[model samples]
Target: MTSTTAPKPRLSIWMRIGAVLLGLFAALLLLLALFPWDALREPLNRYVSERTGRKFEITRRLDVDLGWRSAAVKLDGVEFANPSWAREPYLVRAERAAFDIRLWPLLSGRVVIPHLALTSPTLGLQMEEDGRRTWALGKNTSDEGTVPVIGLMEVDQGTLDFLAEHLGVDLHAGFSYDSSRGEMPLDFRIKGRYQRQPLMAQGRTGNVLQLNAAGQPPFPLEIDAAAGHTRLKAKGTVAELASLDGIDARFDLKGQNLGDLYGLLGIALPQTSPYALSGELRKRARLWEAAGLKGKLGLSDIGGDMKFDQSQKIPSLSGTLRSRVMDMDDLGPLIGLPPTERSAKAIEGVAPPPSITEVKRARRDSGRKVLPDATLDFERLRAMNADVKYTAERIRNVRELPLDKGSVQIKLKDGVLTLDPLNLGVASGTLAGAIRIDGAQNPAEIRAALEVRGMQLSRLIPKIETMRTSFGKLDGRINLSGHGNSVAGWLGNASGDVAALTGRGQFSNLLLEFMGLDGGEIIKFLLRGDRNVVLRCAAMAFDVDKGTMNSRSVVLDTEDTVFNVSGQASLSKETLDFVVRPQPKDKSILSLRTPLIIGGTFAAPQAGLEAGSLATRGAAALALGALNPLLALAATVETGPGVDADCQEVLAQAKRPASREAAAGAAKAKKQ
Candidate 1:
């Protein structure tokens, strides 16, 4: 048994055949090396062309190394021309594509590519403005049989550059995939930047995005992005690709500064406060049929829920917004308006005049609960209301009257909107009124009413510069009504009334000065008690008509003087026509009855005395007193006219009884 085995050991048919096969392969290689490479160039070109559907060119030099288990193929250039969709061709340009082929898989009639490396690949994707995309796969391929299924061992480093002119979008990306399983695991990074600045935002997002998706159809993805100083993170699973149904899990966003966000978006929000924002979005569906999406947004102290449907043409959306108290002045700069003007001169005229009156009428309209679309809608907005206080050291009006320490409150709508009242505290009282605005109309309307009470004459006289000629401290009430489309129009249609009471006041100085009596003591008088000087008049009341107030008697009480005045005044043009009669108890200081006339606008007023009336009244009074002293005395004592001697005699007679009683008492005592 031992005999033979060792000696005959090897010589099996399979071993002999394997040796022969090896020898034949070596011999074939040697022959192939000796042959010219051009002889096989045509065949190689045909093979590459058929496989890739691209024209292929082979170089003259080909290096084959049997031991290295590889072949080096140098190509001049390669280009892939895609089939045309609408008479326009799509192209892909590559500088070179070099790869390694594993020899072991050759025997199995399979091409197992160990590694594929592309140097520089330029892909051009186009879309017409009419919405025709060039990269769309052909319908014939989808209608035909199943596409070939090939497993690629690995794609090492592949760089692709895509450009689309119509979209103004450029994409540069690098990726790799493992194709062992039917599912190819892919990891890619791409960046996109818009070519034009959007109306809502600006700036470029360089190195803005990074993404990784692994494990194929139902792969998990993670995205991180940076835009200016803002950063965002997202992660989710692509669970069902057929319908793009999946869930997105998110954590709070951080490090997003409001100022920085505005800068990135090229927007300038009103100069308010800086705030932080954080939120999450969940249950996202990107499919067409079941197009549903929901999310929540949180900004600083504000929070809300949002929902949308992509299936709708306009992408229906609904949400609620909430915020904390914010200042109204901060909104001024945002809307390109000045917050406050130190001087009226600094204040710019209203643009086309604010429609304050129109807004008021609209609010008063009976048709709808809402103030109509003419008014700005603050939808579902809520906040803590705050009061705006305005303090000015001194305020000067158009009449050149200066007011001091004036303050007023501006009621704010939830601390977001404000209405300017244009009122000030003066004369130990407050001026109050409301102004309504309607901005929807081309030329708006405005209506306002102001009530003034207990105003001091000393303070008010200067306000009406025309009244400077009148003297004494006066107290009165004024009511003003304004209606018009513009400031000038409103002033032109203004109507008001003033009622005044004067106490121990005198008008002598004003009269003398106005009459041009140089150093001549014409008349000196005093008022003992309260006197009514009523100004009950309407300016532009009836069809731009006017009314007036007239007084029957005005008496001035003093040691020996009595003055009676009567007048009718017109308010619109500020004209006064009056009669002044002066008389003395015992003697006449001015032998005259004067007719005084005041006429002019509020800006400038003039007064004149009639000389003829004064001379006639003086002569008559003197004649009457001389004719009947007793009658004149009676008139002087009771009716304010008399001769000085008669008046004095009557006064002495009235004092004689006390002297007579004293004399009788002394005589009786002496007799006793």
Candidate 2:
């Protein structure tokens, strides 16, 4: 009871100095294995090259395994000559170097990094091609500050080769990191293979990245990435990222067959058909400018919004796009047309004696129409906000022809281009119109007007294959106006007016079919099943600059034949000249003055019927008196009466046969 009981609890004095420092660390690991570790290998290679400025070589079996808190140094190679970047010197070549120097966690101060193993490591990176980048840590070692954190590092099965001559990349990677969370917890894994496929990634950060680290969440982070068929995933939280001054991100990206991620990043990307993306990104930072970005993108079904200014070099964009229906014959191989069924089999392989100045320059270039460079610009185009629709069963140049419905909307500023008035129902009629295009200047001007109603002259004459003419239940109404700078000066300054009404019709070979004549005699006719053949035309309002088509009236009806047709058509060049006069249903039956030369070139025309019938004008003066047999002895010595008595009765009726049987019975009664 001497009350000095505390004297009994005497394991004190720092427990006898931790039992003599654990028996002097077990006798210095048994005298460091019989001592002669090559005599401490030159002061442990000058203390690992003065703490890793990097250049050390010490290997001859120096292994200290104090009950497995190991240490191994079997490295016959170690060279890191990047005294902060020359051109290419970040050399790291290793073959086994394991270390774990745990001296009771540095005598309980606790900054334990108990393991670091590297085996077979070789890393190389270089970039130079005017865009110089050889990261042996230079640029004055990144301006001499902040880059010294080598905690928890490991690499196994490692091999990395990267080259980026200004982005003509070549990369092969495999990496990993773990910090064992004594202070802030971090874990990372990266796997690789480039051109030959396979790549993977994983990440976790901060408060042991939660798994009951007391439900940790101070700065959670998650990441996932893949290669080959590409994929990416991300999760956020960086503790308000420096007070949200920058780096707030959300992302999701997916790709499968993005043409195999553009052939594993060699990039050529335009064989379109499989895509995916998702997004949200916001960034801000400024201290003499360095970061600012705003983004929202959702692709492959399109969506967009973007802005950038921190070295993103002038970017601005806004977007809207939706597509479901498309196929205007695949737009003729994207506008190099000549495939519309091979240009309609090259105009049906034309070869029907065709060369009347090439069929009058193919009918004066048939309404000369050509327009396609693809521009229907819109600034405020609203076809009900365009959820527009389209469908097609047929679209033809070689004849499928049914395009039952259509839609259009267009608008353009300053130079005007507006067209949103189209009400269509084609293939036998019901079309409406609206047009305006005045491309401001230089060879651009057009004014359109199309109004076709109830039009089925055999579905608009097979789209005018040079109008192989047809007419059957066609009620017409067409009014077209035009201005030009091309398309043959807009059809030589077009002027149109056509009115047709047919219940039944036939007019074949009008001098071989409407003045294309060619060896005529194929004049079929039938349009009087009850009178309605009327053609009232106009062009001579002062020759309309000589495009001439003035036939005030051309009436012809026939249940029993009656003709009173007047004409004056001179479509300029390529044959169609008329002066026909035949008004006979007994007006003393002596009216026939056909001096019609329906010329040529509208595809083979040549009709010159000039026999004004008074008996071939006396048999053309007896064949010019037998082509001057001395003018047939001067016409038989002027067979009396000044040798002109109607050419001596045309050589006495050319030895008549009842006046050639009454002129072949009145030309077979005037062709029935």
State which candidate has the highest TM-score.
Answer: 1
Model 1's C-alpha root-mean-square deviation from the true structure amounts to: 22.9
Q: Which stretches of candidate 1 lie over 4 Å from their true place?
A: 1-79, 82-124, 132-134, 137-156, 176-192, 195-217, 226-231, 239-247, 251-276, 282-300, 324-672
Q: What are the clashing pairs of model 1?
A: 355-438, 356-436, 356-437, 357-445, 357-446, 636-641
| TM-score: model 2 vs. ground truth | 0.24
Measured with C-alpha atoms, the lDDT of residue 215 in candidate 1 is: 31
Residues 59-159 of candidate 1 have per-residue lDDT tens digits of: 34333334356554433344545535423232444555554565766665445443333445445555556544434332232321212222221233355
User: In model 1, how large is the Cα lDDT of residue 659?
Assistant: 31
Residue 319 of model 1 has an lDDT of 39
User: For model 2, what is the alpha-carbon lDDT of residue 175?
Assistant: 45
